[model samples]
Target: MSTYTPGESFAHRLDPRSKLAVQAGFAVAALAHTTVPGLAVLTGVCAAILLAARTHPARALADLRLLLPFLVLLPVVEGATLGPPWFSVADARAPALASYRTLLVVLVSVAYVRTTPVRESRAAVQRLVPGKPGRVLGTGVALVFRNLAVFRGDLRRAREASAARLGDERPLVDRMRLVATAGLARALGRTETLSLAMRARCLSWNPTLPPLALARVDVPVLALACTLFTWGLL
Candidate 1:
């Protein structure tokens, strides 16, 4: 849900590739270091990344609210047992750490998403990867970034419309069905519209994109990424 906003923050000025590298490195590190001490260090790193992006931790967590339930559920499901004890704390610890690691990775990613523009992200992807496959992946990334907010809005509207019709009074399953069906229909309609718009604009794989250049400032950022990657490997 965190979209790019025009800003002069450190993260905004850094090349998208650097940001992407940090995200990748952080994910690797988080996965490699799932211990309490490791997570504590990563949490501090995550906070620093958020600060660099000029994003608040609360806002980042709020944006990721949709995923929180599943994160919370994972440990619970893992801990639950069919025996008399019903639950095992030892069994839950590993999954709980894993879930926390996942959260840290996602929070780091939120910084990238918030600071990097969709086009820059696409360009970075295409640059990192070459040729037709890269173009296709870049196109997919651009479309997803651009359309996600619109799709979220469509779903919100659908839900509000359903509520206006007293749909909330219906059974939970019925309400879910109505909202889901409406959202799906709207998504299909939007997909068709997007296709037509692309055709009208003559969407091409070789379209001009904003140039990406790493500045002197990016050196430290890249170094940080490398450090994280090396730490993960160690």
Candidate 2:
């Protein structure tokens, strides 16, 4: 739940488009360079980006805790064998690297989300793209950003209520099903409410958005993004 926090940090001052570019470029670079040494470098870059956003690495990881199980499971499953030589470190290496790469990309994205406001992100998208399609994409981004935290909160409350009802005594599968069903129901209810609220507020495709502009400080960041993209391509 690393939603935007009001701050005067360096990243906060950056144009949303530049921040988006950095995310895109970092993702490309991460995908292109998944080796040990390359990942090490990218790790440093990721840390630097987090620092620039005034975000702690531990906090970012904590925000991503929900996905950690899958990240851990992938390599383990890939390395496991049905026969003789059992688990192969060789078989696991590539997937392990790939997972770590994914982690880096996600961390970068988290940094972006933490620093950039949902409206600014929507404005950036609408500006970059045009017509009804841009508005559609922008609306989708805004809804995802705004609702993600609410959805997480719903799931948390459902889990807590389940635990209070002695859900811990239930089978693991049953507990998961209960939580998932509760969360889904809550989410659907919220969606309907949100739709009504939007209609009441006269939600428009061309709502006035905050102005976005690249400052002198943004030049270096854009340059860094370009450099990362070029490095990835190379």
lDDT of 1 by residue, 1-234 (tens): 878888999999999999899998998898889899999999999999999999998999999988999999999999999996999999999999999999999899888999989999999999999999999999999999999989989989999999999989999999889989999999999999999999999999988999989999999999999999999999
**How far does residue 51 in candidate 1 sit from its true spot (Å)?**
0.6
Model 1 lDDT-worst window of ten: 1-10
lDDT scores in order = 0.93, 0.95
Model 2 C-alpha lDDT per residue in residues 189-228, reported as the tens digit of each score: 9999999999999999999999998899899999989999
* TM-score of model 2 vs. true structure: 0.97
Flag regions of model 2 displaced more than 4 Å. Answer: none
Report clash pairs, candidate 1: none
Error of 1 at 206 (Å): 0.8
